[model samples]
Target: MTSRAAGASLPGLTGTPLDPDQEEARRLLQEELDSGDYRVEESWLVRLWRWFTDLLPDPASFGPLPGWSTWAILGVVGAAVVAGVLFVTRDRWRAARLSPTGPAGAVLDGMRRSAADYRSAAREAMDAGRLDDAVLEAYRAIAAGAIERTLLEDRPGRTAHEVALELGPTFVDSADALRRAGDVFDAVRYGDHRASTDQARAVLELEARLAQARPELGADRHPGLVVPS
Candidate 1:
């Protein structure tokens, strides 16, 4: 009789099963091969390019248009896309220009309302129990009142913190309060925190005190002048 090789099954035992260890190993190898974890993802720029190309009219549908014509069409579409991007981000660009040196979200966009108007609005909001709105409007009143009184220059990109620091020397007694008020304003305006009644009252009281206090503007009165902490 011919000798069979080790671990080799004879023709009569073709149905022989693998050992438990071998079966488990086979399963683990198969799983590793089938997993999607190793697949490389396409970069965003590549995806964007694919999307743009997909949006273009099929050249075949254009009835054998000249190569130059195809390029010209692509140029027009590209220009339109660029224009749309700029239009959508126009506000951010304006904000950047207005506040190149200020903190993020600190840009005081040009407000059409005067300081008195903001103060009145803040009071109304407070009475109506809109603490958040009261805080916002009261901070605006502080900024606007300073600008109106020439304590702060009415520049396009002036921020709340900048206003506080600039007016620190002028309002020596309330310097820390001004800084804290600025913090409260930023928290309500940009942070996830909501304004509480106490915070609203604090801002309102600060605004009132600032209104009553006279600013000491001297020969050094100018923009970008910050008091040292």
Candidate 2:
């Protein structure tokens, strides 16, 4: 018939006895509290704020406190630095993911072949009446030849329009041909248009012309500059 205070024992069934381990734990907790070694319960927000402040450098350790404004400025600067670092790291990771050997393998996703190989393929496709394939191969041959002749660098994911633009500035004499070829290729590739034998033949003829075309160096060009072999 003894009454116990709410904090004297753990609340459970009215007549339930405390286990020996529980009693020991309660005794230890009480001793710690009496000795002022126990921490008071903190709200979640206060705990999170404490953790965040712990991550920052101590202004008092650096020097005498200028003011609260100085601490606020330091906190802002620290946050900006962290944000900038995170942004740069994210960009580098994205670049790596888009690399030739990365997961996407964007640079190596397309068919890699020599100009002669592409020409052979084009001929076979044309003979088989695969006009679309023929046109695609013929365009590939043109791009391959330009790379081989050092007229253009082999860049992945370059659209036909981009190729034509690149060629126009370098092979001024074949600008019209390059543009036409690009237009035809883009129409077949992206515009849902069917390729014709004539279009394929035109692309092949343009490729041949571009293979022989050279860059028109202006008078202001470096006289000592040696062409890439």
Candidate 3:
């Protein structure tokens, strides 16, 4: 009896008949392997490439989104971004609005009083034992000094606290004093707390300091001033 050779192809295995499509696929696969395009599964680069390809969107499998829906999604995202920006910048915008150069200052175009007058009034009030009036006048003197130095612009209806807030940056060295004077003025003018001669004197001292002080060069300048935009 004759036996088949060890390398001989069998009909059930290597010699099985292939359809046209299968034959073409096998031929393409062989060509790819010969051209070094076929990578082994054990290769790290091959695994990484497969992972990256899997993560990509399948355009053919998933239908494209409608134009309106896409636009709506984009619009919502854009609006959210704008809202976030506005929220972050709300304080800055408010500061700019309340600035001497802003609309807040427009109404008080010519309503500014001289610092000397305010100081004189403060001294008179102090001599008269009217601590409340002295505090108010002293605080006004500080504001007047700020205006004279162009560190602030006069605006009507602005509270003492508001003025201090605006001038705090301009008087970095005297920021605490300005704020304290504002608080004292507010307490005497608005609150039920009565002003004392000491408090009035403190405000006067702060006013003197502010009057002698120069404008901070690095301070945020008014928009009307010729500053680097």
Candidate 4:
């Protein structure tokens, strides 16, 4: 009898058997569904169908937009913004582009021009016997020398003071000389005092020394790029 019962159990194993937990879960799900466990959503498809049937107008009656215009409103706004930005940045951009670039020749050319200007001014001042004007030209010359000969490059980024400071101790004596020259000129011109011939000679000699110091500061020369001095 046990052999017969084993044979029956083997046949049942060959077929799929229902799990007790799964069977219980299925029964609970069916009961919940029968009692309406889920909330029903409104049928969007039915609503859309009803709207199309009841509310949609004939396509042939539809007209184009009222203004019959293209390139309206936003185009004007975009153009105005672009124009404004260009107008604002125009001068600065031009200045930046035309500003000096690289070193050597550029710096030299600028220096040459500056030197010519100062010399012209100095000569005029000398002719007029205006000591103050002469002193200003002398200072201008020093500043020009510092930028043109001392800097490896003549780009627009550096200021006079910065160049002067970078020149180390050499600038000290030169700056003092020019500054004293200015004072001497101020005294001679405004205070009704006269700068003696010796004083004029000393000022010119100091100017020469400062010019000499400029090229010395550019000791660390670069062929085509900016160099540290």
Candidate maximizing TM-score: 1
Best by lDDT: 1
lDDT for each residue of candidate 3 in 173-225, tens digit (9 for 90 to 100) = 87787777776666555555577778888988888877776666544545443
Q: Output the better candidate (1/2) by lDDT.
A: 1
RMSD of 2: 17.3
| lDDT, candidate 1, 56-130, per-residue tens | 778787587776986798799788778867998998974443332423465355556888999999999999999
| Candidate 3 structure lDDT | 0.67
**Where in model 2 is the C-alpha error above 4 Å?**
1-109, 217-229
lDDT of 1: 0.76
- For candidate 2, the per-residue lDDT at 213 reads 57
Candidate 3 stretches with Cα past 4 Å from truth are 1-112, 218-229
List the global CA lDDT of all models. 0.76, 0.67, 0.67, 0.51
Stretches of candidate 4 off by over 4 Å are: 1-113, 152-168, 171-175, 182-202, 213-215, 221-229
lDDT, model 3, position 42: 72
The alpha-carbon deviation from the true structure for residue 64 of candidate 2, after best TM-score superposition, in angstroms, is 99
Higher-ranked by TM-score: 3 or 4: 3
**Could you tell me the TM-score of candidate 2?**
0.46
lDDT of 2 by residue, 22-95 (tens): 77768755765677556687996567567766787877778776678697877886686677668869968644
TM-score of each: 0.50, 0.46, 0.47, 0.33
